[model samples]
Target: MSAPERIPPRSVTSAELLAEGELTVRGRIRDASNAALFCTVAHAGQEASCVYKPVAGERPLWDFPDGTLAGREVAAYEVSEATGWGLVPPTVLRDGPYGEGMCQLWIEATQDAELLALVDEEEPGPGWKAIGFAEVGQGRTALLVHADDERLRRMAVLDAVINNADRKGGHLLPAPDGRLYGIDHGVTFNAENKLRTLLWGWAGEPLPPEAVGVLKGLRDALGEGGSLALRLAALITPAEVAATRARVEALLASGRHPEPNGEWPAIPWPPV
Candidate 1:
């Protein structure tokens, strides 16, 4: 991370902070290697959300040192927007004049409501299906056991392509509208050593029409010029990208990646 681009903070005073103490924060609170505050904001005429590092933590990611967290966040946002799939909306990551940690936009999500309801009821039903991919449909919906087994495999391959380290079932939120949303992009597009998830069970398989369509749409939306390809070029090596392209093509040709081990790599423990 480096000094973020100079930009005005997206105000959310009109939307009112919804955190534990009315503080504007990112939407999801995570206590991983570090404690990050997540919240959603809509005060700036549109909904935006962001995550920031707490002043106190074990040790920040090497790339996110003084003045760099904001920069990394900005770059991450640029990449997410460049990619068509819905991402946690980006916001300006700024330094607080009073020596406080930074703040950014809140990622809007439909998971909060649905997850709470499902947890309270101890299960999900109807519109929800347990696809058994990574952080998707875990705990909230009944595991589809054999549900779309092959599609689950393709999702894994995509995770590998994106180098999405945290693709647990919970990370893939299926909105009521049926569109699956992917989030938690703290780690992506880095050219080297992109290993951190368990989504691909069918590596050599052909991508479903749904996935092919979405990927095609996203690539088209990216157009010929965008920060995506460049950022990836900078962080993700062309060789890696080429390898991924080859892998995708292979999967398309075969329609599935198979493992005889008879167990999925590390999908969410329980399909929601």
Candidate 2:
């Protein structure tokens, strides 16, 4: 067989390409829990790689209503955009081969990026922050640590706002352009507190000044009749939208990274 078609260089308006292009499924991303098709979208002679997850393929979750994951993913992207973080890649909700689904720009992660590490030391030393300990086969344990990078810190705050229940290490993509992108946001924006993540190194620490400014902007954007609030209301339930606004307010009031509330699992199963 001939080699699969490679995507051409993407333009600055990649989101437009994803929303209006012709999407062709190239292959299946077998590792995803849900059906994640690796595809290419072409529009106006511009082609780029993307992932399409049909709403029909989403698994039912007891906590979240079925078939809403796609919209939640889009909602997360909207929130990310409002924060001006660009933490999530360009994403859109569009009809695909199977049905309506979430389409997101596919980001290539660098192989040499060392974001998470398993160290033998008790403390995380200088540039790392501890994320509790983990078992390493033969009844031994090691500390799980992630980089003390600003990108991840922004992601943590984003996760809290979105109530991302599964911020696994694999979801983080360190792009070649030195920017970090987080994917797999299907299980986010629940009405309840379900913020599970591995980037809890800054838990309980004061929010950075930059983050505070962004939060202030978010607060305004998520208020009643605000653009974000209206966008999210259409995607998620009114209750979930209110919950999201409340979470932002709580974060601003506390001015610190959120700690595990102890009501649910702090870290996702099979972390990483």
Candidate 3:
């Protein structure tokens, strides 16, 4: 069989294509912790590669309730869309071969896009921001750094709002079109503070003007009876929705990027 064709990101119908398309499982993504199927969705002659993670395949986590990861993935997409940055790819909850699951557009990362690096220098140089130090193999340690691009900064803000528990470097996808996308958001939207991530370079820094404006807009959209509030209510618990609203409010009040609360690990295990 031939390989699936790549979907063009410029398609205005991508969202519709994903929501209503016929999905065919091509293979399994072995590296993924859950049963992530690599599939192709087709609707009205339009076809796109996508990842489908059925709720039945989800592993039970002690902190998060079982069978809710798929919904949380879709919820993260909704919040990402509300941010106006489109940091997360187009995603939807739908039925597939394995039953109900979260299906998302597959983003192919550009081979040359370098978002994270381990440097022997104690501090990061220009065009880079330090994430802290990582212990390399063979009793060596190096500074872990990420690009100082605005795309990542926006993503950092989104991660905070969603209370994402996992923001590993492997989740950051830099597209060929110069757009950055983050994936694997199953462990998110908890009512508690579990915002572990590698994008903490701007921790405690003043929020950019653009970010502040976005936060204000989000605060309104997450209010009672707001469209976002209603949408999130179905995906997560009522307390989680309230917590989402509170996070936006807190960000607006502080007018700065959030710092690690120290109650939880500041970064995810196996950062990459």
Quote the positional error of residue 155 for candidate 3 in Å: 0.3
Stretches off by above 4 angstroms in model 1 are 1-30, 39-50, 53-83, 87-157, 190-198, 209-227, 231-272
Misplaced by over 4 Å in model 2 are 1-12
What digit string (tens of lDDT, one per residue) describes model 3 on residues 33-101?
Answer: 999999999987789999999998998999997339999999999999998999999999998888999
- Model 3, residue 240: distance off in Å is 0.4
Q: Residue-wise lDDT of candidate 1 within 1-272, one digit each (tens)?
A: 99988997655442132221223553446544444666444443445455555434325566322233333334444444443443433434343322233344443446543321122233335444333322234554423332233334444545654545355556655555544545555554444434344443343556667666555544543333533545544434465444434444444455554322333334433332
- RMSD value for candidate 1: 10.5
**Would you estimate the TM-scores of all the predictions?**
0.48, 0.94, 0.94
In candidate 3, position 22 carries an lDDT of: 92
Error of 1 at 106 (Å): 4.3
TM-score for candidate 2: 0.94
Better of 1 and 3 by lDDT: 3
CA lDDT for candidate 1: 0.43
